[model samples]
Target chain A: EADIYQTPRYLVIGTGKKITLECSQTMGHDKMYWYQQDPGMELHLIHYSYGVNSTEKGDLSSESTVSRIRTEHFPLTLESARPSHTSQYLCASSPPGGANYGYTFGSGTRLTVV
Target chain B: AQTVTQSQPEMSVQEAETVTLSCTYDTSENNYYLFWYKQPPSRQMILVIRQEAYKQQNATENRFSVNFQKAAKSFSLKISDSQLGDTAMYFCAFMPLNNNDMRFGAGTRLTVKP
Candidate 1:
């Protein structure tokens, strides 16, 4: 089935450690997004990409960084993890047109900083 | 910027019953799209339904449907014949037409009891 995927479905990392959350979509969608969500909370937009080599920061002002070097892969990186960084990171992609069509979301990466 | 709101923090429904989750959004833009996403215990974020701002007709997908009230800026999700699998965190989202910026509301935990 066509879908978006995120690896390391659950992670427990120590503070000051570096980590990367992997996201890849087989749908060949041009637009991709990264969202951060705490348990049972609202999702905050952290980063987004239009296409290859194009990335932009979202409204949430995340300390993490992201890169879109390939059309199917958009990975988020945290240089130094902190307790505040413990949250679920979700990856999604949409059609070229826009949000009129629903988004395809991945199984998300749940990071727990200890 | 657009903001979405989900008033109910938690809800419960018995199997085969109908349940409605409320959602409201604030936007100056005339055209946009609304969506309901369900995050299961597996942490997979899936789209339950979507409503276009310009379309007067509500959207439906199997047991899932949406009540779209454009004038009131309200889009609510209605799940009929709820099952144990329907238990999840429901999120309301808003996105401007042809734009990639999607905003999510604080989620509401929905429990479907057998």
Candidate 2:
């Protein structure tokens, strides 16, 4: 089974409330990524981390922020959630470069800012 | 910038039949990776198959296989003996060798009907 995990499989909060989506992996991967997806739409990269203390914005601009203080943990936080932030957030991790590289994705958090 | 395209928004196949989902990508890098992921109603992304750009042979995993045409920049997934459990939204992804970001297509929803 995939080792990546995301907490609060679903969340519903009012606008302006602070929320955090938690992601953790036990596979010891160096690369971790966060993606946002709407129902039946394409996934957009939001944030990614190379390792501890290293995080970068992805192709899509996001109001949320992420931190990677540990290799196994990468968390995304929205200081003040809004209805626009309602979507599914996926977390993934991958091993270093190689011919057979692939990613293990978490179950994802479905957030709904009411 | 690399981009993946899945023209088929949805497709259906009878159980035990075969179905193919089309995917195309644009990239300037010679060395890169392609992937197919499945997301069921549970919202968990599952890795279905992967293909390396340098490999001439198509990648296959049991009933799952890929038709990778490097010159055409096309990578399509063929699912043989489709089962009802195979119903899900499938996404095509691209990852360049230099960067860890994975670009995903709009995705195709596949329904294996009984």
Model 1 lDDT on a 0 to 1 scale: 0.90
Off by more than 4 A, model 2: A98-100
Could you give candidate 1's per-residue lDDT for residues B1-114 as a string of tens digits?
688999999999999999999999999999888889888787678888888788898999999999898889889899999999999999999988767788899999999998
Q: What lDDT does candidate 2 reach at residue A111? A: 96
CA deviation > 4 Å runs, candidate 1: none
Output the lDDT of residue A14, model 2.
100
Cα deviation in Å at residue B36, candidate 1?
1.0
Error of 2 at A53 (Å): 0.7
Clashing pairs in 2: none
Model 1 chain B is weakest, by summed lDDT over 10 consecutive residues, at B42-51
List, residue by residue over A4-93, the lDDT tens digit for candidate 1.
889989999999999999999998899999999886568988899999999999988999999999999999999999999989899999
Among all candidates shown, the one with the greatest lDDT: 2
